[model samples]
Target: MNDILFRHNRPDRAATFEEYRAEGGFQALQKALADLSPDAVQQTVIDSGLRGRGGAGFPTGKKWSFVPRNLPGPRYLICNCDEMEPGTYKDRVLLERNPYLLVEGMALACYALGVERAFIFIRRGYELAALNLKGAIAQTHKAGFLGSAICGSGFNLELDVHQSAGRYICGEETALMNALEGIRANPRSKPPFPAVKGLWGQPTVVNNVETLSNIPAIVAHGPAWFKALAATPEGAGTKLFCVSGHVQSPLCLELPIGTTLGEIIDTHCNGMRTGSTFKACIPGGASTPYFTKDHWTVPLDFDPVAKAGSRLGTGGIVVFDQSTCMVAATLNLVRFFARESCGWCTPCREGLPFVQHTLERIESGRGDLADIDILREHVHKLNYAFCALAPGAMGPVEGLLRLFEDEVREHITGGKCPVKG
Candidate 1:
C-alpha cells in the first residue's frame, strides 16, 4: 500500500505532535512561510492537478483561485470536516489518526490565500476526532504554528474547531458557511460562490478535510512528484477509500488514485464475505450511482467512475453481495437523504419524499408497474434541485433503474423481493 495521505496510521494512538514534527511534518508550512510566495503555493497545487475529494471533483487550486484576494474585509478558510455522507468516513479516519496534518495543511492554505482566520466544521458525532483536533490546535498555538504571527512570519491565523450540531447538508460548503455563521444549515444558492463571498460575506475558501491534508505534501514535494504518485497518468496522489458492506475485511485503504476497483476488492478488502458473490457496489459514497460486477475492473477515480456512470464521491466503497435487494438498498439510502433534506428547495424537500415512498412501495411488493416509470421521471426531475443534495439523493435510485430495472420489475411481478430466494 503506497499510502501518502494515510501512511502513518498507528493502531495504538495518534502520533504525537513532536513525533509528527520530527518526521518532517510541518516542514511544508515552514517552507511556505519562509521560502514560497502565496501564489507559488497555489500554483504548486494547481500544477499537481489535485482535485477535491469531497464529492465534487473541482480543482482545489481553482477553487482557491476564486477567492478575490484583493477586495476582502476578512477572507476566511474553512475545512468541511462535517462528514455526514453515508458510507463515507475517510475524513474522520484521517483526523483520528493525525489531526495535525489537517491543521498544518489549513495553516498553509491560510498563508496561500492571505487569510487571518480559519475554521474546521467538524461533526458532533466525531467526538474523538474533535478532541484530537482541539489538542492539535492547542499544541500548534503554543508552538507558534497557529495564532498571531505564526512561526514569526507575520501571518496571523486563528484556528477554530467548531464541533457542529451536524446535519448531512452541513457537508455542503455554502450550507457549512451558513452553519458556521449560526444560521439554518440550508444551502445558499451559488451566484456568488463561497470564494467570492462566504462566512460573514467575506471572501472564503472551503476545502474538504482530505483536500487540505494534501497541501502539506504538495508544498513539501514538487507538483510533479505528487502527480507521479497516482497509478494512472492522469490521476494525482493517493485516495483514501473507506470500504464497507459485504467485504471480508471492511476497512479504509489508501491506494493510488485511479486504482482499479477489482484491485481494491481483491487485495485490500480481501474480496467479498464468505458465502457471498459480488453483485453490485456503490463505487463512492451513498450519493454516487451503483456499479455492478461488470464494472469491477473500472478505475475508482473521479473521471473514470463518472465515465462508468457513477462518481468517485468521497472515494468510499460500499460493497453489495448477490443476496442484496437493489430496490431495498436504494430505498434505505434515499430515506437517509430525504430525512437530511434542509427543506430549502422543492425537489429535494418534496421530490425526495415522493421518490422514497415509491421506492418503499416497490420494495414492499405493493408497487404497480407504472411506479417504475414514475421513479425514472422523478430521478430526472430531482436533478434540478436547488443544491446537489437532491440530485445526489437520486443517485442510488437512478442506478437501480438503470442497472436493476429487471429486479424492480420482478418485485412488482413476483409480489416480493425475488432476490431473497
Candidate 2:
C-alpha cells in the first residue's frame, strides 16, 4: 500500500462528514479563513509553486491572482471535472475516492479568490462523481463550510454542482463556461481568459479537479513546507501519475515530479509487460509528444519533459511496449481527436480527418512516400489552426515522424505494415 496525500484518508466507503472532520480536513479552511488574508493565501500558494494538474501546468495561485480582486462583481470558482484526456484517469480516481477533498479544495479556492458563488462543472459521464460531489457539497453546507456565512466567518459563499454534456472541448475553461451558460460545448477564443471573463461573464477562477484538491494542503502546510515537497526547483508536492498501457502494473502513484521515466516504469509499473520491451512512452497524456527509450533517464517535470520532446500533461504516463505499432497507435489516437473535435474550426474539424485518413491509408498498406509528405504537410498546416486541440493532435504525429521515421519508411517501402502480415 503506497502513501497517497488525498486518497490516504479515503475510507472503505465514501468519506463521511464526521469521518473527514475527524481526519483534520476542514481545519485548513478554518485556519485560512480565520488567520490569513485572501492575498496571503494566494501568495502562499504562489510561493509554493503549485501548478495546475490539468494538462496545462500553469501556476494555480498565479492563475487565481489573474482575477480582478478589487473589481467587485460576482466572481466564480469553477472546478473543471471534465477528465477526457486519453490514458488519463487520475482525476477521476481522486474525485471517486475522496469527494470532500475536492469540496474543501474548492472552498479554499473560493476564499483565496474571494468568489461568492462557485460551480463544479462535472462531465456528464462522471455521474457517480457528480453524485458524490453533490452529497459532499450538501455535507459541507450542513457543516457550515459552504453556503452563506461559512464557519461563522462573515464571508458569504455558495457552491453548486452542474453536469456538462461531456465533450472534450468543454474541458477548455472557456468552453466549460459556455456550456454552463446552457449553450453548445465549443471553445471560445482566449485573451480574455477565464480569469477575466468566465462563467456567466464573471471574473472566474477555474481549476482542474486535482489542482483544486492541492489547495487545502498548501493552505495547511505553509509555502515553505509546500516547496519542500518537490524534488525539483520547479515546485512542491508529489504528482499523481496515471500509469497505463503495456505495463505489468497499471495504477496511479503519487511520486515526486523529478523522478525519471525509467524509474517510474521499472519501479511503479513493475517494468514493461511480459515479452514486451519498452519502446516509447507518452510522458504525459496522449496529447503530449512521445519519448523513446533513450529519453527515459530525463526527469518527468514540465520543463525536462519538454526538453526531451514532450509535455508532462496531467502526469499521465502511458508506456508503449515494443509489440505496439507506432503508425497504428497514432491512427488510434487521431481517431479519438477527430471524433471529439467540437467541429468549431477548420483545422480540428477538417484537418484532423485528413490526418486520420492519411494514417488510415498508411496503416492499411495503401500508403506511399507522398503520404508521409502529406502527413507532415497537414500537421504543419493544421498547427495552431484552432484551439490546443489541433496542436495536441499533431503531437503524436510529429513525435512519430521524429522517432519512428524508419518504421514509417518501412511501411511505405514494403507496401504493408511490417508488424503484421
Candidate 3:
C-alpha cells in the first residue's frame, strides 16, 4: 500500500532530483556505502526474496552472487531497459515518473557487485525515459552520489545509457550483450553465463529496470518488511501491473505481488468495458499463455501463475472480451513473434512463420482437421530453438489448442470465423 516505486512520481512530469532526494531517496545508497558491506546488501536482497520482474523471475540477489567476487577484472552491471514486449510498459512508466529511483538503485547495485562502469541498455522508442535517466545520472554525479569516491566513500561508479536501435531480440540478455558490443543481436551460449564471462569477456550482471528500482525500498525497509508487502506467503514486495485492452480503465498500478487476477480486472480496472464480458486474458505479456475464466482467482505471482500454466511475465495483463476471436488474436501475436525473430535458429526462424501460416489457414476458413495436429506439433518443436523466442511465441498457440480448441474447430469446420460472422 505504501507505493514503493511511485511515491515521488508526479502526473505532469518526471520527479526532479530534488523531489526524489527530499523524500529520503539516497539514504539506501548512503547506508550501503557507509555501513553495510557489499555482501551484506546482497544477503538482504536474497533474504527478501525479490525475483526479477523481467519475465524470467529469477531471484535478484542470487543473480548478483553468481558474479565471481574473486575475479581479477572490472565487473560490469547492465540495467536492462529494453522493454520491447507487447503490452508491457511498466519500466518505461516507472522511468518517466521517477528516474532517480533507478539511478540510486543502479548505484547500489554497482556497489554491491563492485562494479565501476555500468550501462543502461534502453530501447530506442523510450526517448523520454532515456532523457530522464541521463538527467538523473548527471544530477547524481553532481550530488556526489556517482563518479569516483561517491558519498566520500571509496566506492566509484560511472553510469551511461545505451539507446538501442529497437529489436525484440535485444530484450534477451545475451543478445542484448551482443547488441551493446556492436555485433549481431543473437543469443550467446550459456554456462559461461553473463556473470561468469560477458561484455568483452569480463564478469557482467544484467538486471531489469523494475528489479533494480526496488533495491532502495528493500534496503530502506528490512527484508522481512519487504517480504510482508506481498499478499501471499511466498511472494515478496509489490509488483507493477500494466493492464491493457478491453478493461474499462486500462492503466498501470503497483499492487502486492500476490494480487489475484480477478481483483486486478474487476476491482482495480473496474472490470471489462460497458458491454464486453470477460472472455479470456493474457495474464502476463504477449508471450505468456492465455488465462480463461477458470484462472480468475489465481494469484498473479510467478509460482501461482506458473502452476496455472502461464508465466507472470513483466506483469503485462492484456484483457479480451466475449466478442474477441481467440484464433485471430493468436494469429496476430504469432505474426509479431515471426517478424521479430532474429533468424538465428531454424525452429524460430522457419517454424514461427510456418506456424503463422497454419494459423492463417484456420483464421481464413481454409484449415483442415489435420492442420490442427500440425499446429500442435510445431508448438512442441519450437521449444527446441536456441532461445526462448520460439517457445514464448508458441505460448498463445499452445493456449489456443488447450483452451480454445472448440473455437478453432468452429473456424475450421464452419468454414469461416464464427466470431467475425
List the candidates' TM-scores in order.
Answer: 0.98, 0.96, 0.99
Report the C-alpha lDDT of model 2 over 1-421, residue by residue, as the tens digit: 2233554455445677787788788889999879998889889889888888888899887888789866667888888888888989887788777888888888888888888888888878887788888888888888889888888787878888888877888888888888989998788888788888877777988888988887788788777776777767775677889999999999988877778888888987889888999988888888888899889788887788887778999888788887788999999999999999999997778889989998998888888898888888877887767588889988999999989988998888888888875
Task: Report the C-alpha lDDT of model 1 over 1-421, residue by residue, as the tens digit.
Answer: 3566776568868878998888788899988999999999999989989999888989999888888867938999999898888899999999999998999999998898999888999998899999999999999888988888777888898899898887899988999988888988888988888889888999988899999998898889889989988888789998999999998999987889999989999888888899999999998899988999889788787888899899999988899998899999999999999999999988788898999899998898899999989999998999899999999989998999999999999999988989874
Candidate 1 Cα deviation (angstroms), residue 243: 0.3
The prediction achieving the highest lDDT against the true structure is: 3
**Model 1: CA > 4 A from native:** none
Q: How many residue pairs clash in each candidate?
A: 0, 0, 0
Total backbone collisions, model 1:
0
Q: Considering summed lDDT, which 10 consecutive residues are worst modelled in model 1?
A: 1-10
Clashes of 3: 0
The candidate that wins on TM-score is: 3
Tell me which of candidates 1 and 3 scores higher on TM-score. Answer: 3
State the TM-score for model 2.
Answer: 0.96
